[model samples]
Target: MPEFKQFLLADTAEGLTEAEILSVRVQPGDEVTVNQVVCEVETAKAAVELPIPWAGKVTEILVEPGQTVEVGAPILTVDVDPAGGASVNGSAPAAEEEMKPLVGYGSKTVTTKRRARREVTPEAPVTKGGYVPLAKPPVRKLAKELGVDLRALATSVDGVITREDVQRAAAPAAPTAPAAAPVSSGARERRVPIKGVRKATAQAMVSSAFTAPHVTEFLTVDVTPMMELREKLKKHPSFAGVKLTPLAFAAKAVCLAVKRTPDVNASWDEAAGEIVYKDYVHLGIAAATPRGLVVPKIRDADAMSLAELAAALEQLTTTAREGKTPPADMLGGTITITNVGVFGVDTGTPIINPGESAILAFGAIKDMPWVVDGQLAVRKVLQLALSFDHRLVDGQQGSQFLADVGAILADPAMAITY
Candidate 1:
């Protein structure tokens, strides 16, 4: 007979006092292996899938889905054997319980009061230190979104933790008390509950805003030719059902512009005291969804054809809006582009996405007076704003990238020249 091993949910990061078990993919008596995704736990940032630390037989699932549990809490129990063979007496090593692998935050055996009133009756809810667990407002908000009940949690006896508990709190919530209802209504701002990826984005944005010195530059370009080319392309048989807009051209121009200017395709590495330039392009498209603003990058956008890029963009936007974007797809971008023009706006000083060097904002393309053939003529024009890290890219390099993009939009024929 082989000695048993028990697996646990190890702490992934700090400041995570409690977690909401979003889903349990594995059940008791199920055979599991190392690196197998057993469950997904929702922290304040995003829901992360936790892999089984070591291989074993899942003896019991200690937690339920949608249950809020503190960090270091027991999530599951697994039975394991040393070398897959012997009992503790023979080939198995000494029972060093604390030396268990992935038995999360280390294991502790506790003796609980056995049920005596169990003549076919439900047992009382478990409480910690003779008091029900209590969480603060923000924690409560997170638990609510994760479908957790604070009253069902187990906390220390002294319920000293209140709404004013500052440490370990990250979620931002605007109070919706009845007295403040009038002001909220007057602003007409929809109070979207912050959770999931949106909450993570909020934290990143705040950190970036305060950490980085954001500088934005704006330019106006005549994109009449680009718009015309889009119309012409749509008439082609292959482009049927594909909405060809100036954005597709803009994205292509950005890719070309990046080749000319590598610094724009770089990131500021503060700790390393260097600017890291990427050889490839992970172009991000900033899309506005009902959930929030999500920038789903089309990996290796430089290699994709016009048709492929358009299709990719369409799919990315659709998935983002439906909140079906996978965690892997949301990261690793070199640069970003936002189409503010769709909302009928004309240019804005957009903020750079965190970790990336630059972000381009495309304004509405409208008919305006322009100098075509050195004469004042009415032509379709668009404004472009390039926001870059000054530390990484100087004005000269930034201006050149913007100019290249503008030139492409000014005359789609220039795309052939390049």
Candidate 2:
């Protein structure tokens, strides 16, 4: 008698929650082993490669790419045996099922037929006359960027074309004037439909901004010493190829400040009748991805060095830009920092991400006139804004915490004393 084991789904670093299948890597009859790469999944955070735990021949892929799947749902099936050879045709060996963990370990045998899916109308329809009219999501987004029209593509489908079809069609017609205006907007204004990260962010921001009484405080600091230290460190062989920004130093400063001011590292629990101050810091870095703004937290960021923090920030930004950040990395954040300086913008009074008590916004660094040692001179200066909930923190405490962070960034050497 042959035995079987099902490899249940574990957390994919950047997979979706409702299980949308993006792509499948293996097929039936393929022999696989434990820890072998099974598939690549696209989640809210980043694209993650999933590993198969049990070794066996591939039986069937239950889901297809582009379809979302729920957690704990059966993703794949495999056969296991005492002799190391299991077949799907063999009877259910009771011994194997008995050994399976009851909860959260492996896949459970769900007895239900798959549901039929509804038909989806393509945005661009393939019409007769040799014109294939259709656009994928990326193409649609590109068209919005380039100001192309799906209706125009449909009316003038010259050949079997895709999103690449629409792009090629609009590329040569560049009149260099007003032809690139968005079709969705007025002749002067354009409107792009909200979807993906932008859509999710809009919904979340609306909920947070409307629900919370947001209060933001700003502080302009002379970070000349910090900037000088960063320039010196950039020349070091260890800091090669890393994009060293003042924001990195700012992140470290925030972490150090949180160590002394634990109240700022907390969440509001309305149901529990308490403001929970966390002993551990899950430092959230707000990243602006193509999808929208996402806050992926670095677990125990307080324990990492400046180099480690730089690497983590690099990983987070890259994963975020690629739309592969894991859902787990987005959770459990007590405080957040958003660097709007990348866009060359000054400080913004940002709204706090719900559940987190405070969020700091870092603005662009620019040369400005300042008084140094009672003399007016040009120096590199930057602004920092801290938005917090007055319900959890008072103005005095918030001011002091912001001051401490500014003091650290103003003199990177002070971090050693603090």
Question: Which residue ranges in model 2 land beyond 4 Å of their true spot?
Answer: 1-17, 79-204, 235-243, 290-292, 305-308, 318-327, 413-417
Tens digits of lDDT, candidate 1, 43-92: 54335677776776666677998787755456776666534554223332
lDDT of 2 by residue, 109-133 (tens): 4332232322223664534563434
- List lDDT for all candidates, in order: 0.71, 0.71
Superposed model 1: Cα runs more than 4 Å off: 1-194, 369-371, 374-378
Residue 124's lDDT in candidate 1: 56
| Model 1 clashing residue pairs (backbone) | 5-78, 5-79, 5-80
| RMSD (CA, angstroms), candidate 2 | 13.5
